[model samples]
Target: MAKLKLTAGRVRAFTCPADKPQAFLWDADVNGLAVRATLGAKAYIYQGRLNGKSLRVTIGDVNVWSLEEYREPKTGKVITPGARPEARRLQALIDQGRDPREVKAEVTAADIAKREKTKQANTPALEAWQAYIKARASKWSERHKADHETMSREGGQKIKRGRREGMPDKKEPGILRPLLELPLSSITRDAVAGWLEQQAYRPTRARLAVSLLGTFLNWCSDRPEYRDQVNPDACTRMKKDLPKPQAKDDCLQREQVKLWFHHVQRISNPIQATYLQCLLLTGARRNEMAALQWEDVDLTWNTLKIRDKVEGERIIPLTPYVKSLIDGLKPARVVLLHSDDALKRSPFVFASATSTSGHITEPRIAHNQALKNAGLPALSLHGLRRSFGTLAEWVECPAGVVAQIMGHKPTAIAEKHYRRRSIDLLRVWHVKIESWILEQAGIEQQKEETLKLKKSTAA
Candidate 1:
């Protein structure tokens, strides 16, 4: 062994090269031990010798650990040479004449850890997840934003409705409420595990809640920040530790959809009726379609520029039925319909009278009423969007093309960044989708049906 040079950088130069596989020896200068970098890289480690054995510790990157930056693992504070805690421990071990084999073993494990980290090479999970999200930053929106952020943003933590509420409402959205406020890093896997442990007995919600959290965090692991730091144990092997809950079998029956549409047509609020019809026809999100304006609709061209598109403005094909629905709106309401305060200032297509500018904060009561009138289950207005996806798949719409209409980021590997703007294909999807829903709803265009019904009532 060479005499200690007494400088941090020069420490590496004095150490002997490995004579055998995975050798461990103290650096003579500072007695901070050194080890080879992992994955054939220039990384090395600093080991602390205490009690006649080395306590393995991470110094820093091979060339990057400055004298000023050198640290002790226990206190996480800087240490000067000769006064290094590990060196003091080694002196104590020497005085006792007891070999620090246990300490050496710990150092060996620490060295292997340093090498293993080098092998990962790429950015951490949190980093990668953030970058992935940022890359598709344009695709995110409050209407459809939760799907992407559900994981890192604590989308998994489910809050139960109080025994009194029975269901989520405007003041509280039930189990989904609290997690939305927290970031991924703030909650530890232990914290999540503890949360899951509390709810584990409630198999269905427990699985969904934990799975959502796990999947999101798992995705985070692919990124750089959490890859090494976040634990996999919390989410993985869920089926083994806690069984998964059975998922709901969704989709309204054709008769149910027909019954629902009939009631939808009679809902006193014409705009709500029209918005519901549009939902059936276009399968767009409520706000995305609700925020439509007369300008976005081109009666002459028979198309609606779906401005509420999650990604950006997209031109949705307006079918004859969709056109009829729009064309038939009473002229008196058109002014209010497009006015910012028409629906209490909501600017929503289904704006309530209470909202300003036709804008609505939420449509909970109205939507539920419509659903109940249609005699449908407790499905969400959002579920209608899912129905559209299912039906589109049923009708054999090309996966890529349907994804485009849904405003989803394309999954086709070669089609990821494709910006196709042709309306020819979209027209086909719009028509097929409309036919499917209208067929389910039993809505047939009766030219004077509106008149005949009015006359019968008047008579």
Candidate 2:
């Protein structure tokens, strides 16, 4: 091997022979340090003996690295600038009977681990929340999925309607947005408690947010990537600070039914008005009814296939008035010469043109307005469903019949194991209940015998 003191000019001028793949110019000062040259590139390299075997390692490209040492201005520390110091360090490791290759591998692995740790430490809770939603979304109902999204949504979007005169046009941030904006590792118990305190004004929503947060933390702990980043016990003991949830009992009385019907029927949007009526009559949940499609209704069979939360789906009788309301909403089929020119109909039953969701979404404003006009205290949409179950007692309907109609899970062995009534059998008690409620509400209902005769005639 040839040896010479390496300089910037000499290192840059070094080249390999045309027939050779690579050539090296050894440094006289540093035994292992050399400038290696190939057809396309030049780099500083080191060659040393480790455990009596020859070893080689590339230090850096000659274009990017300096051949002389200097002081770092920021830290005021001596900085080793070139491949010479690196070669000396590797020679010291060789003196210690350590392979320089193994040392480099260990340092590279440590750098990677440090980078990963820093990345995970700075990862936002919102990222984990999104991953959790995506992982679990397939199993969740549309309403349940919406609830999770609503909690963590970043607000400031322009409002379409219902902005008060003096209020800002942009909407407020979601209840969980502030907390979820923080890094996942920073979501400690104290942090969660502070968030809960900030959201104390809306206890109902705050409680729901905490419950969701707890579930999310549990999921993070179970995942290998997120396990070390999350504090699973962050939500534990949080309920002590939170207010206990009050059970709602807002069912309509028999006498109030007339007033409720009168005001609700006067609503300007017929789709909303009919939806409110169907909600009360069928005893189905608010979301279950809102998600109703045109295909779910069967006027010929007088059956409504309700998408059940307990079961996958449950078949219930589409009572006369409910059937009539749904019938009125159907688009008229026009005779068309060209199929493409014909109007495309919406799949949702209670269709809305303005909503992103094809069907009606927020009917509470209209419902609340009607409640105010009728001089009724306040009735939630669920109250209307509850009213159906309560009012079913008027006609002495059996518990099992009402439970099946309302899509309630059977509480007893007999109801769960032995009671699977046909849709026709359910219709018998269902129509009777619907008639009694309508009669109480000052609405005249056709007799069951007349309805049966009409069905037979139509058939």
Candidate 3:
């Protein structure tokens, strides 16, 4: 080793020999500090003995670090004490039986933790809301998942449809957008109450939003990462201020069926017309019918497999008129074919080529128009389903039969535990009810004898 007093000129001029991999010039001022030169680069380094073992650490680049202390000319302030003082600090730690490497690691870890804490403190509620949706999405239905997404949307998107002449082209922000933009920890009970007050115009939607927010906060409380930032009680006692939701009673009357069926059959789109009629006849929920795939309908067996929210799935009699309506959708399905194969058809029974879900999305516009054309009172799509249960009473159909066909949960002990009517028995009552409704609407359907003969012949 060669000892020399390090200077700017000397440090800059040092280089490794052609045959050697590296070379070092020891500094006389600092016992452990040296300038190491590799084949391609030069850097200041420190070397010392700790616990009777040799230890080495790189200080910095020779061009960036000074050989001695540096000061600003005007203020006489110490800019840097240079690599020599850093070397002395490492030596001091070694003398005290402490490893400088461990001390450096501790300082780095503490800095990282502090930054993480600050980042978590500033994290928006939207981020956690997204995480919550992702974690729980698999357990929810498609409609339920879409509800959460809709409530949290930031809005201002271009309106694709339903934009009136004077209305703004952009959609408004979602109901929960304001609260979701806030920091996660800032969602206190008072903040939730204020949000509810602002949304008082739409009490029904706001009440549902509050319920969703409360569930989200509960999910966050269960997670260790978000536990400290969330107040699970933030949504508590908020619902008391909002009005209770009234049960809808917009069902079709027995006398109005004639006019309702007449106008509904006149809908320009055959799919929409048949869909509204099927809703009335089958008594199936709107989503369950819309999401019906081709495979779920068995025309041969006269059965329709419905995805039930409670029982997982339930099979009901696909009544004669309803079967004919579905059969009519086949030609339209043929028009949607991408290839010349006639055997292939759209997966959805109520298929829509334009919809993202490959099925009918909104039939409300056409339905409302049909009602208006008939001079009938307003009746929603679900009202058609309610009408089915209501009309079944005219035939004196058993309550259990209607409940089973509608996929309603069993309420009576006999209905739940003892009564397990087969599909054949259900079909008997279902056909009679369908017959009675069609009689009121003045629509002539095929007789059960003809349907049975056709089934036997097809077999």
* Candidate 3 clash pair list: none
lDDT of each: 0.58, 0.85, 0.87
TM-score, structure 1 vs. true: 0.47
Stretches of candidate 1 off by over 4 Å are 1-189, 199-249, 308-310, 329-348, 392-400, 413-421, 446-459
lDDT of 3 at 308: 87
- lDDT at 429, model 3: 98
Question: What local lDDT does model 3 show for residue 356?
Answer: 69
Instruction: List the candidate 3 regions with Cα displacement exceeding 4 Å.
Output: 68-78, 161-169, 222-228, 335-344, 446-459
State how far residue 23 of model 1 sits from its true place (Å).
Answer: 75
* Order of models, best TM-score first: 3, 2, 1
State the local distance difference test value for candidate 1.
0.58
Please give, for residues 1-459, the per-residue lDDT of candidate 3 as tens digits: 779988989998999999999999999988988999999899999999989998888988987888777999999998866888889999999999988888889999999988886898898899999999999999998878988999999889998754545889998888999999988899999899888889987888998899999999999999988888889999998999987777889999999987888778889999999889888999999989998988999989999999987788999999888898888788777334434434445788887766667788789888888988989998888898999999999999999999999999989888889998999999999999988888888776655523211121213
Tens-digit lDDT track of model 2 for 1-459: 889999878987899999999999999999989989999999988898876789898888887777766679999687656677778888999999998889989999999988988987887789889999999999898778988998898998998765545889998888889889899889999899888888777778888888889999999999988888899999997877877777789999998988888888889988899999999999999888988987998878889889998898999998888887888787621222223454557777887665666677889889989999989998889998999999999999999999999999899999989887988889999989988887777775665523211111212
Q: TM-score for model 2?
A: 0.85
